[model samples]
Target: MRRLLFIIIGLLSLVACKTDKTSVPQDFECFNQPHIYIKYKQPINGYTVKVMWLQNGEVGNALFCLEKQEVQYYYFTEKWTDKILYDKGNTYPNNTVIELDYTTKLKSEEYLSDDSPFFFSDVDFDGKEEFIINRYKSGSRESNAYDVYNVTPYGYFIQKTEAPFTELENGQCKFDSENKTITIYGSNGWNNIINKTYQLKDEKFELIK
Candidate 1:
């Protein structure tokens, strides 16, 4: 009887241990929290990539490689950001130049200029910076791409760009800092033209007309 009781106690102890183990959550488990998703098309490779940012989570940035059919993870903190490419049970090398190119284009213009790329600067002097991208036609045969960037008190920078302007069309920008919004003025060389605004909130960027 005493041996049987000991066996029962041992089983109960094992059960208790399992219960305690499950009580503590694993750090790597996904919490399904609110996050932001951003998508952009690569100018060089013509690949559609998705960027995800988990708001207030451990995973700072995650990239989905649509062309290569893979996923790349990045850990970002206030000081630095590190990228880890998961491939076949091993980490692959990160294409920082390609990533930076895509990110710069996404942040500013759709078409990236090979000669005069877009720039960033702090135009409003509000400590927060902005982006400036140049737009020009390939057939124009004119050096129309002019971009610049200026530093700001805030961590980010500001941007400015120069393009062709007509009497009916003028260059202007509209900003909404509270919602992190940016707008660009478009011209059709004639009438029926309107200003367009873009909002960058929660990792998603949308064009508002």
Candidate 2:
């Protein structure tokens, strides 16, 4: 009888441990995490990825990668000013970027998982930070594709799709802020390697020696 009781207790303990992992803890600080990660499972091929990174206590930006669709971008402010809903078909017209609210009751997986490839940095040496998200890495060469955005003073994201920014799509960047230059390392064709340097000039990237 005691052996059966011990087995029952062990099963109960296993159930309890699983319950803990799946639910949000009561003391979770929703807005002030490293990066907000919320996963919403879909009924079909894949799930949606919603990630918002807070630069300060007040403002940040978010990226939405819905399956089979172009990735959408939005910015947020004052923590609760923008509320991002997980459901589809909500409308924002004219293809302009909008503000997404930062309201989420879901427990963030930021602490449970490793840091994602999302962050804010001063990539232009303009003393203002830019947002960078590494969308994916290509095969073998591990070429990294990036979405780099310049944040406006009014909390907007203007995507930089020009020269050096375009160069960053398939290569890794090492920024030298003091020298105001970017060194790129990437491959052109199979078995052909390239190392190039570019200087940040007039808010543009110019290829130099």
Candidate 3:
């Protein structure tokens, strides 16, 4: 009876250990301002974690909590010194924290420099610059996927996911106003390079070959 009791207690301890290993953490900083972009890698409870978030007015916000293989220690402000780096491949099991409509006044302490991920450029040739954000990193060539939000005449942001915008992912773009074309060039993955040119007509993109 004594041996059997000890075995049962040991099994219960093992189960508790497993449960703790897979448990997710809950504490994190939340922002309410638009165009908020934060990126940092740090260690928490023996695991390496990467945090990244970007917010836009009306359109929404996105956050990523990635698990990295190696642990890195970073100073709070000094961590913002480097430009954003693209991921080499898919990350481990991770979490995402979303703050959809944080509508608070901008605080001075939460201010980020021009190293933000948001910008504006005219992709549809409408004589107005559209809102653009470097959404995610993809491919082995350090290319990025972009989110293009067209600015309406009434000052509203509408996301465009059709051609030209869809095909522009995982690459770098160059806009030519004279030729009325948008050129995207970058590596697709390990072997292939992407170089596609598209012309805008009637607010749509047509492949120019």
Q: Which structure among the candidates has the greatest TM-score? A: 2
Q: Residue pairs in steric clash, candidate 2? A: 82-100, 82-101, 82-102, 83-101
lDDT of 3 at 106: 36
lDDT of each: 0.35, 0.46, 0.43
Candidate 3 lDDT score relative to the true structure = 0.43
What are the runs in model 2 whose C-alpha is more than 4 Å off?
1-115, 138-140, 169-171
Query: Global lDDT for candidate 1?
Result: 0.35
Residue-by-residue lDDT tens digits, candidate 1, 113-204: 33222334343334544433333321223223333333333322223322211111112455556766666655566776657666664544
lDDT for model 2 comes to 0.46
In candidate 3, how many Å is residue 185 off? 2.8
lDDT of candidate 2 over 1-209, digit per residue (tens): 43344345434333333443355457643322333433443311222434333322322333333233443333221222122322342433212233333223133321111122444556677877666554333213534455567866544466776767666643255768778888877767988988789998897778996
| Candidate 1 Cα misplacement greater than 4 A, ranges | 1-170
Ranking by TM-score: 2, 3, 1
True-vs-predicted CA distance for residue 99, candidate 2, Å: 21
